[model samples]
Target: MVVRRRAAPPERCRPSPYGLRPGWDWTARAADAFGRAWHLADRYPYRGTEFDSSFVGIFRVDAADLFSAAPDLVNPAWAEATGQQLQDMVPSYDFHRLEQLPQVLVEAARESGALPAVRDGQMRTARVCGLRAWLHGYRRDQAGSLIPVDAVRWDGGVHHALSVTDDSTDAELAAAARRAEQDAAARGIKLIGASRWVEQLRAARRTAVREQLAGLRDEIAALEDRLKPARKRRTVLVTRILGWDGERDTDTALGRDAGLSHTAVRTLRTALEADQEDRGGEEGGPLAGLFR
Candidate 1:
């Protein structure tokens, strides 16, 4: 057997653009060291760190702010480190929602004895908070990157807002959303608790119901087509029988076996004869046109 040795990745010692303290350079170093492994490995193992076991969340920095504030430092290498380093190094931090961010940061700061800071000259705090709310639990995968968690599909807010089963159909979801809406309205509460989730549920239900109704309409048409021959034969027979007895009221026996009322049987026979005449001539029997 022949064995081929794998070559190690080229070493990178690029200076931090974020003006990092000595150990904090781990971000860039991690990108340099672990980027290939994360990209290439189907299942990359998490490297246990003091942060991982303690539930310590990484202090997230805005890539946009980094780009705007220090445009000169926004090279491809820096971008790669900024985007992938923390995500690869600390999966626990990436697993949380934005609503949990304040608490996560607070806990991390308390444990680490270092508080997260925003530069005074950066965008106003209100803008930051609003933007964060708009982007809560949002992550998108870039081309050639690892498959990302579909944030909307796995939204915690939806799970907490309403109870749903795995097998819940669109109609069931719609009904559940409507019930939830009514409950909220009764309590004078806003149904915006789940961020347009109710609307989405309703839309899904409408689409499903429309599809089901369309399918049923097709089935009904096919059944009517199959019943046409039988209906024509019944009409011809009814005409012959009615000829034998001119008293239509005495023909209770006509519909008794079919579980229909005498009046219903008469109505059906009349309609069938009319339909046959509309198609052209009644070709069934000699008495076919006599009752009309």
Candidate 2:
């Protein structure tokens, strides 16, 4: 016989759209970098310095907030590092005003060729808190080479309320009433015409009790017939044994003489004695003693 081998467990795989594998550090770095960029934009003397600072801040910020605001410039070292980090991290920063930071960044990365483009009409269900709109394109490598990505339709809040209308007719009302009656009967509740039903149930119960009594009487009769002794067989066997001419004294014995085992002879004698006692009680007289 050949032994079967069990299959190995499936290995876990990373999700697609694989840019950089993000962890706590990467996210913190991205958030810090992006936050720093936002702050730099606010405090930096020049627009170029502010923009550059944002990229470096991206490295410090969480990847989830990659397009979010830059960290505050409370620490000069972080701001200085952001300026340098922005040189390369610029492609990673997708500008999100107050909301939609990560969503914008994801769209930007997809457009800039940093991440693969998804299928059309996809990302329709993607959402980022505080995001107002989607970014359609982004600039990469400062080469004036623009990459175009799809825009997502945002419908965060448009409600259509429905009102109920009532339209009941006489026929409909009659039908509903009939259905209610049937339902009540099915649930064991009294219906309008329940008296006839109660009478039928009582009749069925009486019929069942009568049938049970008849069956019991038949069984008792069968038991009584089985208990009756075979008088002709007993008499013939006893007469034959007592009349035998054999010299063996065993022929005269109750069981051996009758060609039956001792146990069978004792059982037959007990049954006969019980029957004689029953007859004596039924006779209700001293003459019954003779029969016993």
Question: Which candidate has the top score in TM-score?
Answer: 1
Per-model TM values vs. the true structure: 0.33, 0.17
Model 2: per-residue Cα lDDT over 1-292, one tens digit each: 3333344335334211113322211233343344555455444444444223333212122322433333231223222222223333433442324233344555564576433224452332221221111111111222133221111111210110011012334444344434544445454432332222233334555677789999999999898787555544564455344345344534226666556666665555454446445654556433233334
Best by lDDT: 1
Which regions of candidate 1 are displaced past 4 Å?
1-151, 155-193, 246-249, 258-260, 267-292
Error of 1 at 62 (Å): 13
Off by over 4 Å in 2: 1-192, 230-292
lDDT of 1 by residue, 1-292 (tens): 3333344445345333223323333332243334344334412222343222212123433433322443453234322222233334332222334343344443554477433344552221111111121122122222123323222343333543355544466666666656655554454433332224544555565688889999999999999999988777766666565546455434477777555578977775676556555655546434446345
- Count of steric clashes across candidates, in order: 0, 28
lDDT of each: 0.43, 0.36
Task: Please give the TM-score that candidate 2 achieves against the real structure.
Answer: 0.17
Give Cα distance to truth, residue 122, candidate 1, Å.
Answer: 30
Please provide the root mean square deviation of candidate 1 (C-alpha atoms, Å). Answer: 17.0
Give the TM-score comparing model 1 with the true structure, all chains together: 0.33
